[model samples]
Target: MEITFLGTGAATALPLPFCNCPLCCKARTSGGKDIRKRSSMAVNDDLLVDLGPDTASAAYLYGFPLEQVQYCLQTHSHSDHFDPAHLITRLPEYASAGVVPMKVCGSSLTLKHMSEGVFREDEGTDMLSPEGMQKLSIQIHQAFPYSTFSAGRYRITTLPCGHDPGDGSMVYCIQDGNSTLLYATDTTSFSQEIWDFLISYEFHFTAVVMDHTYGSGINGEGHLNQDQFIEQLRIMRKNGIAGEQTLVFATHISHEGNSTHSDMEREHAAHGYAPAYDGLSIRI
Candidate 1:
């Protein structure tokens, strides 16, 4: 599977407007691969996880066929993770596609709020009907652990993401014929329940792109810092859940992560996993 990290910053973005912190300043001056945006990604050119506010711009900038994407699985209703207002443009009025409408799935809050929030606006979404859902192959399934959804060539199993009240988030154990990938983010630490679920599973994980919103000794509730990521990596390696060949990447970064993305890179390299950046394409 080819996994591409379209954008890797948190909602506010590195160099968040007006915050003259060290991280933001370094991001402003740094010119190479260090430029990052909000978190969102494309898998094997078909499946997508999260539709952050950055999607439209990233789609244009990174050269992914945004409208032609197969499945869009939302993790939660967080505006940073998913901004349906931005996604609604692809529905009917903004971009006219000759093919099927986009498939969107998530928890109830994600789907319902997106529908009420975006499609109902200025009648910009008219072609979207129940038939469009069928046409695009968009099926809303409850994001409970171990429940699998088979759509053509991909087999998607939803796992729990640690965050929020009862609203919920998810991790996808996505598999094709031979390889499997775990798309997990927006989780602070890998919760014990989720850890147990992965331990019970059989496939070798090719890659894992996770939230590294914090860096070093900083702490937070719903997101993982660099130190936390290192801890989790150790756990995975020790438990045989992952190995040397299994690539680990940290993403969903904030400008407050450190002085620069290099700081994050150095720290992550010390732990052995690279920090995921925008437009990074990895094949597994």
Candidate 2:
């Protein structure tokens, strides 16, 4: 499995446009890994996790071919994560040629909101309707927490997340061949139920990309800080969900109390994971 981080910044991204904080200022001046876009990921060349507002830009910047993506696992309807305007571009009206059919998997509520978002952009365009889906060459697969489903060559298990409970936000455990990945972001610490589920499933992850929206000692609602992030890694290790060879990465990074990409790597190296930056790709 090859995992490419299309973007790895929090909702506000690495640098606040109007703020001149030390971190943001440094990011503006030193634009490399420190520069981040909204959070999103691509699995191999076919599957995408979160078709966010920055997805196209990230793909262009990172040299990923967006036309090859056939499946999307949407976490929620958050504007930063799901951009109806972008999705709408696949429509025939845009004159896009040979667009690959896409299957979008998410909670019912999330799909509903996505459909509504499309409608908002183009009046009367309902993603939930068969006619609308056919027009866009897309399919909606409503997923529920704890359910397992197949998308192409991948086996996906949906796990509930602590953020946006109203939207039934979910994280994913994806398995392809000998590799398994746990993609968890835009979330708080895992719940006991989720832990129990992982333990019961006996899932051993090859890679993990989790939320680290806040830096050490900083508290953020509906997202994990550095301390909480480390604690979760410990629990994963204790439960045998992650082994010593497992590749772990922290994503959804924010500028609030968080240092630049290089500094973050040095700071977090001892914890068995490094911060993921835009365009970073790993294969297992």
Candidate 3:
């Protein structure tokens, strides 16, 4: 199995537009891995996690075969993670005839937001055309904690996390035979119930992707900093959820963080945490 990071930055991305921050300034001049887009990932070529606003741009820039995606696994309804406007581009007018109806799997609240954005059409105003909704095809599958479902060749199990209490959020455990990966984002520490559920699994994860919205800072109730990330790793290892062979990654980066790409890689090398940049692909 292969994983492709479509975008690996926080909500505002690495460089905020029209800002003269040190990081953004350097990013403009030094355009390599320092540049980042919104957070999103693709599993193999069929499953996508989060349909962010940058999904279209990332697909074009990185040559991601998004047309092959059959399932969209949403973490939350945050604007950066869920962009229904961009998703409509897959309608019959824009996509090919072979494009199948995308099966979007997420929490009830997340699916509600998607439905409202996709199906809600105001014929009274010419702002959003009804043709897109009329021609588009999608199947919404509501996901809950501990519930497992199959999409294509992948089996997914949803784990509840501490992100949003009102709408709720999830972390996904994806598996295809022996290959297993945990895609955890848009959430902070794992909840007690989630931890209990996770520990029951027999095998260690092949790769564990974490949320790093804030770097070396206090917990923001919804995101994880570097300190929290490390602690979480320790706990996972102690609980047998991760082993030395497991590949660990930190993504959802922000320019406001304490370190740059190179700096973070150096600082976290001892802990075996690799910072994820846009377009990075890993085969597990």
Candidate achieving the largest TM-score: 2
User: Candidate 2 lDDT, tens digit per residue, 1-284?
Assistant: 98999999999997888889999999999999999899999999999999999999999988788888889999998998999999999888989899999999999989988998999998878888999999899988999999999999999999999899988899999999789999998889999999999999899999999999999899989999999999999999999999999999999999987999989999999888999999998897
TM-score attained by model 3: 0.92
**Candidate 2: minimum summed lDDT over ten consecutive residues — where?**
61-70
TM-score-sorted candidate list, best first: 2, 3, 1
C-alpha lDDT of candidate 3 relative to the true structure: 0.82
Show where candidate 1 strays beyond 4 Å: 119-139
Task: Pick the winner on TM-score between candidates 1 and 3.
Answer: 3
Lowest-lDDT window of 10 residues in candidate 3?
A: 121-130
Off by over 4 Å in 2: none
Which candidate wins on lDDT? 2
Give the per-residue Cα lDDT of candidate 2 at 263. Answer: 92
Residue 232, model 2: Cα distance from true site in angstroms: 0.4
Question: lDDT of model 1 at residue 171?
Answer: 64
Ranking by lDDT: 2, 3, 1
Task: Score each candidate by Cα lDDT.
Answer: 0.72, 0.93, 0.82
